[model samples]
Structure formats: C-alpha cells, structure tokens
Target: MGSISDETVEENADAPTYVPSLPVPNVQELVKEDPLQVPDRYVRDQDDILQVNDMSWLSSEIPIIDLSLLSKGDKEELNKLDLACKEWGFFQVVNHGVAKKVLQDMKDATTEFFELPLEEKNKYAMPPDDIQGYGHAYVVSEDQTLDWSDALILVVYPAQYRKLKFWPSTPKGYKDIIEAYSKGVKDVGVELLRSFSTIMGMDQDALLGLHEELVQALRVNYYPECSRPDQVLGISPHSDTSTITILMQEHDKHGLQIKHNGGWVPVKPIPDALVVNVGDVIEILSNGKYKSIEHRAVTNESKERISYASFLVPRDDVEIEPLDHLVDSQSTQKMYKKVVYGEYLRSSMKRRMEGKAHTQMAKVET
Candidate 1:
C-alpha cells in the first residue's frame, strides 16, 4: 500500500469536488410516456449510430476464463487469460467466486429499485452538480446527444467514499445486497489483478500494492425498450479508465458489444458468467502489451436490459504510467505520460463518453 504524501493532498485538492452532469429526462419514464416518439436529443445522426447487423464481421465468441482454474494455479488457464487480455481485451469468467445468491439478490434489488414509482426513485436523484445518485451521466450539454438509459452510480468501496444517501432504501435489502455484492466482486478483481501481475513476471501483489485505497465504483444501468432501437444508443462507445471492469448482465438479455477487427461483436450473455474487460489503465501499465477495447451498449426494441458494472480503479494519489520493467523491454517504449490517478480521472470525468478519447490524452508524443 502506498503511503500518504503531500503530493497526494495537492493532487486531490485540484481534482473536481464532484463530476457534474446535465439533467436529462428520466428515460424509463419518458419511454413509458411515449415509446414511439424519441425526442430529438435522444435521436442520433445516422453516422453516429453504427449499424451492427453485419454478424459476419464478428470474430469468434469472446474468450471465457475460469477463475476457479486460475486460483488452482493451472498454467494452461493462466496462458488463456494472457491471450484473452492481449487479443480480445475482454472475456467471460465462469466459476468466479461471487456467490450465486449474492448475484441474484443484487440483481433483484436493482430491478426492484428501477421499478419503484418515479417519485420514489427520484428521491435519490443525481444532485445539481454531482454524478452520484440516479439519472444520466456525462450529459454535459443541453444539446448533447442523449442515451436511452438511466443509471444509479455510486462509489462502493473504502467505506468512507460511499454516498449512502444515494443508495436505494426503497428495496428492503438493497444496501445490504450492495455491500455483499461489492465485496464479492472486489475479491474477484483483486485476484485477477494479482494474476495480471504474475503474467507480467512481477510479484503477484506488485500492481495492487501501488494504492493504499483502491476505489471501486458501481453503475447499475437500466435501458428501457425503444421503438426505434436502431436510431438510439444505450450507451456511447468508450473505454473505461479503470484498471479493470467487471459486468454482470441480465442472464437472458443481450446488448453489450465490443469493437473487434474494426467491427462490432455482440456479447451473448451466459448464465452465471461475469464479463470482464481490460481498461485503459491496464494498457498503460502494461506498456500496450495488453489492450483496452472499445465497447458500447445498444438499445433493445423488444425488452429492457439491465447491467451491473463494477469499475476497479487505483486511488487518487497513485502515480500511473508504464511500469519500468515493461518499458525496459527491448520492444517497448514509454507510450503514456505519467500522471496522478486522480488527475487522470478529473480529465476523464470532464469529457463525455466517446470512443477512447480519454485514454488518448495520456499518450506521449514521440
């Protein structure tokens, strides 16, 4: 764990107190009111909405990694994981230790919270200049194109960082489920990070040891069915700034897609499997040996889709850059500039989600 320092304090002070987003119509409520007529702001230009119907371009199914095997020190599974990160930047993990009961309870709680009366759900609405609570995120302008989704986003780790008031209480066991769920997913993330460090020929704990307080945030997204699904997006294409992100999709619904081979590949939801992806921070740390893939959510015409995404990030004070050993390799160079994690976050939260723009900001000009 990293020790506190004066530099950390200064960096935190400069970071925005809160990442605010513009208020957007409650997409769930709006769809209920008029599912057939999408607001002009919600409709994107034809060019903005990429057609993903060309299934032939999709590569083979996203690789699946067995956490159970990895935990047992199975070398073959470890190699598969390395290949998954390098080639696909995404994978599904089966037998991930998150309990089935915990997953179900949280999924139920999320659905119940979203089904609450609009007024009840709005009780925890995103405040005037804060991204926490419920509503759209990264909606920075009045004219900004809107996504057809609503989300409850909250920092769920390190105890003190959690905004309990924004946590849903309407669902009787919501808070407890969140606590249980976060702990389980965090365990999974830590194990994965350790495995990553091992893959890099470093001590298993080397990477995670950079921060005394790693941050874990949860975003529960509710994408309502849309009449014109082809014209709207559930979420814009973007790469996460986290070290890694884990997502639990509703078992029977499919909307997640990753950009591969210059085409969009749909991710089919598997029962009891959690999808994991490499984030920009991982790419930066690995000196681009691993990649962070661009992915987006598409709106569904016949049914609503819900997903739970847990982002695991380094604490604000940690300095992030290509690890020395990775850069020292003959074939590699320092591709990204070193920056405090908090400052990187500040830059990311300031911009709307688009492709991999935020990650590119860290690249060094050779």
Candidate 2:
C-alpha cells in the first residue's frame, strides 16, 4: 500500500473533453451500512428489474473463439468468427496469449483497491464536472434510478489521453498491471477488427483504416451484494457504443446477462476467457451485418461481483458510417446514418443508460 497525495488530483481537476455525470452515492459503503433497506432511489420497478422474464433461452451459449486457431488462418475458425458476429454478437476468447499471472495480478490489485477505506478511495473520486474517475457514470440527473455498483472509468490508450490523476496510487503496482492487461486486451481487439474486415471480403486494413487511431478505455465495475437483489440492477441494460467491448470477470461470479431472442441469458464464465461483444460502431460499419447485443448486470444475493470492460473505439473525430464494401450499389439501402465519434460519445455521456438507445441515434430509418 502507498499513501495518496491530493496534489495530482487538484492539479488536473478540470480535465478537457470530459463529460460530467451527476454525483451518486457510493453503493459499497451504503451496503455496509445496511444491506437490507435499499434506498428508494436504488429500488427499481418490476419491468426494469426483469427486462426479460423468460429464461428458456439459456439453452444456447454464446460462441467461444480460439485466438490461436484464428491466428493460424484456419478457415473454420474464420467462419465461426463471422457467424458469431452476425448472429450472437457475443463470444468468449480463449488462448488469447495474455498470461495468467498478468490477469491475476490485475484482479488482485483491483480487489485491494476496492477494499481500501472510503476516504482513501475518495482521493480518486470523479470530479463534479468529469466522468473519468472513481464513481458512478451516466448519472445525469438526481431522479434517475441508480445501479447497485461503483465504477472507475478511465481512458487507458492513446497514452496521451490518460489522466493519471484519477488513477489509484496504492496497491504498489496497480498502474503497471493495468497497463499490461490493457495492452494484451488491445492486441486482441485489433486482431478481431482485422478478422471482421476479412469476413467482409475486404483486406485486413479495410476496417482498421476507417479511423486514424484505435482508442481504448476501461470501466471497472464493483457490484456489491444486495439483500434485496431482485429489486436492484447492477447495471442498466444497454449496448456498448464502442467498436467492440472486451470484458473480464475478476471474481468468478456470475452477474452478466445478455438479452437474447426476447429473453435474458446468463453468461457463464469460462475460467481465463474474456468475453468479447460487438458494439454500435461495428454494427454501423458493417451496415447492420453485425449486431450489438443488449446486456446488463444482475446483483448477487450473497457474493459480490467485479468485472472490467475494455471499450475499444475509433478516434473521436472520425466520421463513422456504413463501409463502402457493405453499402454497394446493389444494396437495398444504407441502414445507418453517418456519425462523428466525438459527437456520438458526448451524447451518450450526457444521458442515462437506455437499452440500445445510443445505438438508435445512428440509425437511418427506412
């Protein structure tokens, strides 16, 4: 453990390009105070509580992709990747080349971070006018329903974009572990993008060329156990707005569920495998060939859950739209309108999470 100094946080209080989220109560401490009587604000209605009532859809599992096979140019693996994107829009990645020790180190550091005293953790709290820090995100108003979690949101890639002032200075090597894990995950993301381009019958650079740079950010969610778990959601159902989201479940606990075929299916965690899912950007660039799945986190009745989601996006200024290959003259219509990544991101940050609502902003209705 290391001591936290306020100097760095004070110096960068007004970080540029940040979208502000309204301050929210810290769920972890609140639960410690009383796990039973959840505040009215955290209590959600039945519809919100159970987005999909039917669970018969759990019979099918999301696709699992082997990176080693894909790297070998295996035709069968390629076909599987293509089908996974177009159909399920979600998959688990194995043999991804990220070392087990690195992953475990990150998980341990994060667990230690959340275990710190509230006041110590508060040293990295999200500023009143910026969302990139340790706190709830997308809380745009006081009346909005709250999720039963606390999150640390940070931009990790494009190294220049990182605001280290918001990063934890404790647990000794927290920063280094996060950097190593992020790099490994980023390599996977770029490779997946290449696979997607190849699937579309274009060269490897086809999709990668759409943006000037690949941006990566991370959101570490800490879902505390709730006594009235049925009444509170860990996170609201929403599709990621990035090009792709790579998720790692740190605690080996089940909380992630994706909406599938009009019902919700719990995502079973495969040890050492990371979950990857298409996002709105891919859906738009694919001209709707690839769909972004709607998913949410459910609270556990007894155990806590922690997950890290790495969001890979394009450069903020790029104009994102259906690719030329997907929107050929023979095509019936272009399914999505063009959007500037920065504008789309700002819009998403300024509002609360709504199921697939951010993705809808880019749709070109027929």
Off by over 4 Å in 1: 1-17, 51-53, 56-60
Cα deviation of 230 in candidate 1 (Å)? Answer: 0.4
Q: In terms of TM-score, how similar is model 2 to the real structure? A: 0.94
Cα lDDT of model 2 by residue, 1-366, tens digit? 332333244444333466888887899999899878799999999987665675735624689999888877789999999998987889999998889998899899999999999999999898888777899899888999999999999888877777888888887868777888899999988888888878888888777788687889999999999998899999999999989999998546888988888888888888999999999899988888989999999998898889999999888889999987688777448999999998898888888898888777788976
How much is 208 displaced in model 1, in angstroms? 1.2
List the lowest-lDDT window of 10 residues for candidate 1. 3-12
Model 1 accuracy (lDDT, Cα): 0.85
What do the candidate models score in CA lDDT, each in turn?
0.85, 0.86
Maximum-TM-score candidate: 2
| RMSD of candidates 1 onward, in order | 5.2, 2.9
User: What is the number of residue pairs that collide in model 1?
Assistant: 0
Error of 1 at 66 (Å): 0.5
C-alpha TM-scores of all predictions: 0.93, 0.94
